[model samples]
Structures are given as structure tokens and as C-alpha cells.
Target: MPFFRWARIWVLSLSGLVLTGSIAAAAVPQDMQDFNHYTFAVMWHPGVCATWSNAGPACKDLSPAAKINQEWTMHGLWASRPRSLLAAGMNGPTWWHYGCYWYNPEHALPKGSCANPPLNLPEALHQRLYAHMPMAQICLDRHEYYKHVVCFGETPEQFFPKELDLLDKLNASAFTAFIRDHRGQWVARNAIMKAFADSFQVKNADALELRCENPSHHIHELERQGNILTQAWITIHKDKVDAFPAPESLEKGRKGNCAEKIHILN
Candidate 1:
């Protein structure tokens, strides 16, 4: 471990702040320890709304002309640990879970925007964020900013526009169209992965981790609706995040808890 990171750890303990340190090194695979990757996540808006309790804030009051309502929504652009935090000995998974809190233990990660300081973003970028990520309506933009963007070592001005631009490019891809085509219908997981592979022209789809919601356990009324595609977690090489989906920027990710067949809800 680097000297500065160790010093930070010692100072944090002296301050008596509770720190959820990185997971056990022995328990995690060697590759997972380095955790140097970016997860470019986007959610399927309608499917996200379908499984939640009364449709969460992201889905509420969504306009007929809302872009998020009709397309896959931006979830976040997360780097496991950029070089800025790496020298302080912060590991990837810890950064993924705790973010800025890992580096600045005093700044609590807020459940809502009310407790956090507002982001320093332009009005236009704010509007773009809201359009691409409806959860921004509830100020998740602030949450994402503090938790992840700080690691970028750049102002909200430099960061958000770049990320949203990537989302625009992704939206124009065949992968986006495939999800739209399957809305309110069933899609095979392999077929979806193949479409993603084709869209990015990657060697395979292992770079994308699929997340789905099976609301049956919680909402018994929707018991028969096995699974709804909710989020796509595409692993990007940390060094190549901005050049995303370039074959060199890809990495294998953990494919999540979806069944072989997924239903994309609209």
C-alpha cells in the first residue's frame, strides 16, 4: 500500500469515522482486487418503473415526450478507482460502493439531494441529465456527482457532458434499438447479448452485465411476469472510458441475476 493511503487510513481511524473497507482480499478473486474498470450503466425506463413500488420517482410524472420514458435511461458512469484515489490505497469495489465517502469520510452519502450540496453544473447540462436520466428529477444527479464524479478530478462541467455524449452514441446503436423492439415482449438473454456484441462490434458480450428485476417476490400481483430487463452494466477499461465500446476498452463483467429469458417492459 502507498504511504499516503496508509496515512489517510490512520487519520480516518483517529477521527472515529466508520469505514466500510474493501472486501477481504482472500475472498475476492485476484482480478477483482485491482478492480480497474468503468461500468457504463443504463436502465430500461419502463421496465424500471414496472417493478418498483408505485413506480419510483424516475417513473412518476414522466411526460409523453420524455426521452427516458421511451428509451434506455442513463444510470451512471462509474470508475472503480481512478488514479486520483488509487495512490491513497483506495481499492475498486470500495470506491464502487462508497465513492467520495471512501476518500472524504466526513461527507455522508445522501439518500436524497436535500442533505447534499448542489452540483456545479450548467443549466443546459442539468436539462440534458434529466432528459437522459429521469432519476435526476429526484436529484440522483447530485448523488452520482459526489459519489462517483469527484473521482474524475474534473468539474461537473467537464464530466457530465462527456458522459451524456456517450449515452447519446449508445442510444444511436443497434443495442438500443434491440431493446426498444422487444419492449412489452419476451427476449432471450443470449439474443440480447448477441445484439450488444453486434452493436459495439466487440469480440463478445461478456463486457456487458445484465441486471433484471423479478418483482414477483415483492409484488405478488405481478408473480407471473418472471423478469424485466432493468439495467445494462457495460464494463469499460478505466483508461479508455471516454473512448468506450472500442474493443480495447472492453472488460469482462459479472452477468447478473436474470433468467435465460428476459421480458423488456415498456
Candidate 2:
């Protein structure tokens, strides 16, 4: 089985994009928003697997015993820019791309990163986490842990559970249900954003950034024969993260890459 790799994504620069007209999000109070935000990224398994032709055995396991597509799985709880990395001139996009491997390619393994030191999560967290996060098959857990979580100001115990808790909230929300109910169907991007805002009872849906494997870009997407919804990245204020699913807790996220209408793979 080939290692599951994340094709470089969300590589577009966010600068100079004017928040024009009615879609503009209210200016976040300067004291409230800046770099103190974290992106809680979740993957739709079927779309994820279908995104790449060389996806690993985890996606090939066709067993009913491990139906990983039953729900969204962790991508990572990515910090925008921790102070140390920022001072070192690691801007948001650069930090988002390279993650821990920005410093050294050898810091990451081409195969499974399972050999990286294990996370020190508590037993309870480990068990709850074991329930999903299917990419653990490719040691993606270790990849994400080392790359995104290490400097995130929370221990593995603190980070994973908090992310899991938020995932629960999203799964329970109308947002998740909207996508889940529409699996195998094409849905308008605007509608998806609207459902997300309605689910959280928020004024702005821009807090949710949508990502997809586009047929326009990848041949694997052509194989899927459509645009496939893959991930949703939500911006949560660091201080208000514990209060997520609340309107004020989520800040606006920049636009992401995806077609105007994308399919949610069944």
C-alpha cells in the first residue's frame, strides 16, 4: 500500500482579496482577532480517498467492519502562526504549507511517520480518538501531531480532545447533516456556506473555508469524474475555542479552493 499523501493544497495567496459588497464579514475587533486563531480541519473520507489515485490501503479496505466514511475525520487542528514561527518569518501560508517539515525534509518521513515519537495523550483521549481518524492507518496522526500540533500551546491530551469535542458539535449540527444527507449529490457552494452559518446560528458563513479535489486540477479528480468535497477548515478564536459552535467564537476564514458546485462522495 502506498503512503497516503496530502497533495499540496490551499496554495493560493489570500492577500489583496477585497471583502467587497454584502458578503463582507464584519471587521473583527483589532484586540479580538489577529493571529490568535486556529483552523479546525475535518475531512470527508470518501472524497478524501477519491481525491488521489494512489491513496493508501486505508481507502481500499472495503470492509463493512471499518466504514470510515460514516463521519468526518480529523485533518488537523492547525495553528495560524505561533509566535516563534512568525518571528522567524514563517508567514501564515508558508507555515500552513510546510508545517513542521518547513525546517527539514528529513523531519518527516516519506512513508508512514509512525516512527516519529508518539503523542502523550491520556488514555481516555487515546481511546476516544481511536474511534475514527482513519488516517492513522498511514500514520497521518503522527504527521499532523508533529507538524501542526506540537507548537499549538496544548498538549496532545488537550488538543485532540478539544478538536474531538468540536467535531462532535459539527457532526450534530445541521451543517454536517446537510452534507451527509447530500452525499453523492452536487450542492452549490453558497448553499453549503449558508447551511454552516444556519447550523451555528452565525451571521457570517465565511468562517468556514471549503476545500475540494477539483477535476480542473487533478487527473484523479477526473477519475472521480467530478469535483469532490474533501475538507472544511473552520477558524476559531483561540480564546473562544472552548465556546465554539457559538457565533462570536468563530472568526472569518479566507476563501478556499473548490468549484462553485462540488459533489460529496457517497
Candidate 3:
């Protein structure tokens, strides 16, 4: 389980990176025409685990399971058990504070095609693994809503069509305040945000606005928020409720956690 232990340590370290300035701010990839479409390809239709080893788990299979686990963790369920400890009353500041520990390190490892060019690099394999680790801070809350992870260029509202009404209702004054309060949270909870910021070229404020414009652009923001709330609620009301980790949580850690794992993966 050294790998698992390594994964845990790596994930924690990444969180620190986000807090610091190890990752640079960047915009969403230009090639990514639509966040939903890109996400679908990554989450549901990954053509192959394009890795040099070509021996890791199949991306199609690995990702679906991982996706489910992510959903579970978003809704809390820090660990994989019949009954969640959160449901029994786990006292913690935030459900996501220690949620990355429950991820399945094996799945988080990169499994790509053996012929990829990046593999030629000395640390390509590790880099690829680090890229896929699903380490983030926000999970699904009790309401089955997910918070918006800051995508590279767009605000959360811009990503989601459903949020147009919400955005419209939000005056400039409220919007500014909201952004100030939640920007850090979005960056902290979203691996894509970290990756975009670190790997791409953009300003942090621009990235936050991009995500806010359409939260659904990156992932299902509502789902993310719901997952976080659910996990937190379960942790607070574990004695009176019974919940399980979303399948996604079991597969990959959140953005911060994933970034940490990537550092170690290399």
C-alpha cells in the first residue's frame, strides 16, 4: 500500500500548492470548444487510456467507475463502507477537508496508451498519472448539487445554461460579493481549476468569472454543490442518517487532492 500512502501524501501536498502559487493561472484550452463536451470525452468517452505502458486499466472502464466514486465523495462518504461514518456524526470543519483520503489510489494512477508522445519524456508516465488524478475539494452535497469548479477561462455561470436566470437575478453588487466569497473555494475544490491555472495562461479573476457565468460548463455545478452539502450533512447527522460515498469519490480525489497526487505521481 505504499502507492496508496504515496497517493494520500501527494494529494495533501497538492492542496498546499493551490494555497500557495505553485500553479499558475490559465484559461481553458482553446481546443476545448465546450466544457460539457470535453468532460464527456474525459468522463464517459475516453477513447483509450493513452499511456506508454498500455497496461493500466482501460480508460473507458476506469473512468466510469471513477466518475461514480467522485459523485459519491461529493455527497460525502469519505470512505467506502456499507455505512458512512459521516452519517453517524463525524465532527469536522468541512466534509472535503479530509475527503481525499478515501480515494482509490490504484484507479487514480494514469493508464494511457503506450504510444503517446508524452511517454517519451523522462517523467512522462508520472506526469500522465498526475494529470488524471481526480483531486478536488468540493463533492456533491445532500441536495445532489455540485459546486462549480473554476474552469480555466470561464466563470461558473458561463458554463451552465441553467444558471442564466440565477445570474440575471444577481446584481453586480451581489455578484461581486459572491465571487469574492466563493472564488477561493472553487479553486480549492477543482482539480481542473488547478490544472488550468498551473498549465494554462490566464488570470485567476478571469477564470473565476468564466466558471461563474455557466457553472455547468465545467461539470454539473449543482451536482457538485449537492455532493458537498450531502457529505457535510451526513458528517453532521451521521447518527440520524445513512449515506454512502458517491462512486466518484471512490475513484478519484478532488482537484486539490489530485494535484497533490500528480506531484507525487511524477
Candidate 4:
């Protein structure tokens, strides 16, 4: 399966890093390791492809016939548009892997607005600086363009005073509190879960249970343990099992990974 292949490489590389002292070698929390393993299995496994007949609803929705074909049109537009970095001669896949498929750059928050600033540098400068950054899986979702107008690191007051004013008009603190309280339910409703599940060919509900019920599933336990730093690392760099938003609202803050992206959709 694709997942096994990825896992083999991942494990081998991690081992090498440990041996070489390139990464601090320590036993990851058991739950975290389990979560990572499960995510790896689901995201990379070809079994999902087989189970879903390669035309899972996520892919199906991207087809020409679906109601959401318009969304795919937007995706295609993003794909075809010229990005600043690539030159005329370099015509290859420009999208980066996030969640399940290639992340269309247009769909991504502009590099200038993404979490990292240096990545948003001028094309020539970016080329020189990021030559060695590892290409790994990432997540992509539809974002509210206005919400991200300010650069990611900047204070809201600095870059988007007007937007912040709008947020204030809407009872920003109340909205944030509500999201914090009910985000999971929204994610369960959103198409992201379906995409996550389809990518992994697993039921979203079952996946959650698997993580929670299996003691060997260390990652779930660690998340439950509330180790903030470890959880943050796992969410940001490894996978975001905790970020799944509530299904009822389309709001952000969904616990996700490549697999959950498909599961929530179904």
C-alpha cells in the first residue's frame, strides 16, 4: 500500500535522524506515536484507494458532474494561474501536498499571508533560501480571503484594522468562545471530514473511536492528557487530529490529517 511505503521511508528516515543526532532522540508519547502511525496508515495506504474505487465522493465531487464542480473550477483556475516563483521553462507540478492531494497555490493563503513569512519572499530569494526545505504533506482548506489579508504573524491591529473592526462588530470574543466550544461539531458536518475519510477509506466516526478505544493508540491518550507542547507539535508538524471543527458550522478549527479530510465528508 502507498501508506506502508511512506511509513517505511518515514521510519527509516526517523531512525537515521535519531542515530545521526540530527533530531533529539526520545520516545514520543505512546499515544502520539499511535496517532502518527494510524494517520500514516490511513493517508498513505492504497487500501483506501481500493476500497473507495478511486472515485470516492471526494474525487467524485471534483468530477465534472457534481454540484460542487464550480469549486473544482476554482481549483483549476488556481492550478493554471501563473505563480510568481516558477519560470517559463519549469512546467511541473507546482502544488504542494497537503491533506490528501496537491494543494493549489491559489487555494493556499498567499505565501505572504501563510504562517511562515520567509516563505513569502520574492521568487528569486525564495528559490535560494528554500532549496533544502523538505517537501512533505500539508493540509489545504478553503479559507476566507478577508480573514487572512494580514500576514499570519502580524497583529490584527497592524495589518487589518478594518477587518478587526468588523470582527468587533460581530462580538469577536463571543464568536471565538463559541467556536472553541463547538468547533468539533462543525467539522463533523463539513466536507473536510468526508475528504479526510475518502482519502483514507475509513469512516470518520470509527477512526475517532479507534484512536480513543485502543490504549495502544497513544496519540489520542496524549491529547487527552493535555500536554500542550507535545500536542501542539503533533498538530502542527505531524497531523492535526485535534483540530477537527464541529460539523454544524463551516467555521475553522477542525481536527484533521490526510485521513480526517476524507472521513468528515461522508
Candidate 1 ranges with C-alpha deviation above 4 Å: 1-35, 61-66, 82-93, 111-113, 216-226
Per-candidate TM-scores read 0.77, 0.74, 0.17, 0.18
Candidate 1 structure, TM-score to reference:
0.77
| C-alpha lDDT values of all predictions | 0.68, 0.66, 0.23, 0.23
- Model 2, C-alpha of 154: deviation from truth (Å): 3.3
RMSD of 3: 21.5
Instruction: Estimate, for each residue in 1-266, the C-alpha lDDT of model 4 and write its tens digit.
Output: 33323323322221122211111223211221221111211111111222333223333222333322211001000112122213322233432222111122223333321223222234653332222111111111112111221111222122223222322322223322332333223133235334434433344523321111111123333323321110000111122322322222112222433222122111
lDDT of 1 by residue, 31-74 (tens): 32244777888888876776655445667754535667567788
| TM-score top scorer | 1
Candidate 2 residues 1-266, lDDT tens each? 01111211111111222111111123212221245788999998887886655458657653333446756777777767655445555567777666644433233322446555556456777767766677766667767775665432345665677888888887778888898788778788889989998889988698988988743345444435456888999999988988988998999888978777788777
Ranking of candidates on TM-score, top first = 1, 2, 4, 3
**Cα deviation of 78, candidate 2, in Å:** 0.8
Better of 3 and 4 by lDDT: 3
Candidate 1 weakest lDDT stretch, 10 residues: 14-23
Where is model 2 poorest over a 10-residue stretch in terms of lDDT? 1-10
- C-alpha displacement of 254 in model 3, angstroms? 24
